[model samples]
Target: MASSDHYFYVLQCADNTLYAGYTTDPIRRLAQHNNGTGAKYTRLLKRHPMRMIHLEHFSEKSPAMQAEYAFKQLSKPQKLRYLTEHSSEWLPK
Candidate 1:
């Protein structure tokens, strides 16, 4: 796969919660979450995910997982800030 195929993503659940994950394919991963086939955290959410709020691409899985790790350690407010500050400006809001 190309370097750009790896991604670190942030998802907003239906209940106003967030989930961070690393994936090679965002669309397929999002579908897995919606279908209850992703991470336990997402699968156990009160409802299906609302949308993916942010994504950061990586050339390797290690850095992508590192991003996911770092994102997970942030407080909710900080996470939101990280997303806004880190996401590409051209990405849809």
Candidate 2:
């Protein structure tokens, strides 16, 4: 069976915009985002390198997926504020 641990993440695009997603491997996912091979929204904003600014690990895929959905619903400024307050936990290492 696949490992239960998954991650929901957010990236700060070059344009200072946020993109949220879920994945089993954050390192690879970041690569895809940078390479313009990730989500369509991210691809469109790939003019500026996407930098990982937030990530939350989950023990199950369902919860992580749910978070991703909720994150997508957040307004841009709300997401930015979230990142600001959660900087210590989410900022790139």
Candidate 3:
């Protein structure tokens, strides 16, 4: 089976709140979110210029989506903690 380079990502929105979702291209997805053409929830928030704070690569869309759902379930503080812990791992190196 071909491996999926799908990624589950977390964004720190303009309002400083976190949002989670899966994508094949986080940079483009984030651009869409900032442009008010992404998720309906984000579109209605009057927020923009979203910043990507976390990213996790998965082998398939299904698992990436599952990770997205699980990440979304985290409380804000918990999410922040996760971000802090994982930040260095995904940074350009």
Highest-scoring model, lDDT? 1
lDDT of 2 at 5: 76
Candidate 3 regions off by >4 Å? 1-3, 89-93
lDDT score for candidate 1 against the true structure:
0.83
Which scores higher on lDDT, 2 or 3?
2
Best-performing candidate as measured by TM-score: 1
Q: Which ten residues in a row have the lowest lDDT in candidate 3?
A: 84-93
For each candidate in turn, the TM-score is 0.84, 0.84, 0.82
Clashes of 1: 0
Ranking by lDDT: 1, 2, 3
lDDT of 2: 0.82
Task: Report residue 38 deviation for candidate 2 (angstroms).
Answer: 0.9
Name every residue pair that clashes in candidate 2: none
* lDDT of each residue in 1-93, candidate 1, tens digit only: 366668999888888788899999999999999999998888875857548888888888899999999999999889878877887542333
Reference-based lDDT, each prediction: 0.83, 0.82, 0.79
